[model samples]
Target: AQSVAQPEDQVNVAEGNPLTVKCTYSVSGNPYLFWYVQYPNRGLQFLLKYITGDNLVKGSYGFEAEFNKSQTSFHLKKPSALVSDSALYFCAVRDVVGYSTLTFGKGTMLLVSP
Candidate 1:
């Protein structure tokens, strides 16, 4: 299978604190990376993606991910998180597909408390 891993099962942060969700991956060809955030009872919302260009990819909701080709890592980062930012975050890689099928990790729950 296409290789991908999220090391953290969950992350907790106080309100207005910075937060990060770690991710690592591997693929045969050039990789396309994506990050998604999921709220309860809602579908995965596309946060961002690393398509064919720059290493630092910015996304919605003040989120950004840095794609490291050498390390095979794409870590999600946000400065000064809010309580509303708490959700399940997923890091994905584009596996063999025409529609960019995302191979997701088990997910890391971000608990932001005030």
Candidate 2:
């Protein structure tokens, strides 16, 4: 079975500082990784994805992720943090060879203080 782990329950960062939300995943064969952000009472919005090609992938909202195949990690990164960026972030993975359904991590709440 495929799975994802977001070790941090929450991440705290001051506005204007860089921010990161760690994520690790496990899957058989090639993996399709994704990051999604969910605002309060809202649906998950796609942030970025790592399916193939470039190890470093960029996405919406000044966010990017580096795919480390050896470490099985896809950690999200932002050069600067904003209070408006605070939200519940989730890491998901899918097995590219078999199924298309995504397995999501519990989620990490990002708190950006001004």
Candidate 3:
């Protein structure tokens, strides 16, 4: 089984300040990690993914995540945040080896203040 957790229900940041949204996962086998963002009345948008090769993965809208294998964590980050960046962020995971279904976290709301 594969599962993900977004420990923070909400994250608050000021515009132009750095931001982070934490996520952790568990899987029976090697994991394929992903991050997605959903805006108000919109669908999920792919932020980034970690299949293999790199520990640091970059994504759309200046977002990035670090894959920590030992800790089983993938925390999303941005050097500077924007008011438009305020949205619901999700962490997802799937087992790399089998017919594992993708699982997502409840979601973390990112609120950026100007």
Writing each residue's lDDT as its tens digit, candidate 2 over 1-114 gives 899999999999999999989999998889999999999999999999998999999999899999999999999999999999999999999999865699999999999999
| Whole-model lDDT per candidate | 0.89, 0.96, 0.96
lDDT, candidate 3, 1-114, per-residue tens: 788999999999999999999999999889999999999999999999999998999999899999999999999999999999999999999999868778999999999999
Off by over 4 Å in 1: 95-100
Compute each candidate's TM-score over C-alphas.
0.92, 0.97, 0.98
By TM-score, the candidates rank as 3, 2, 1
Error of 1 at 74 (Å): 0.4
Residue 26's lDDT in candidate 1:
78
- For candidate 1, give the lDDT: 0.89
Q: Clash pairs of candidate 1?
A: none
> What lDDT is reached at residue 58 by model 3?
96
Q: How many residue pairs clash in each candidate?
A: 0, 0, 0
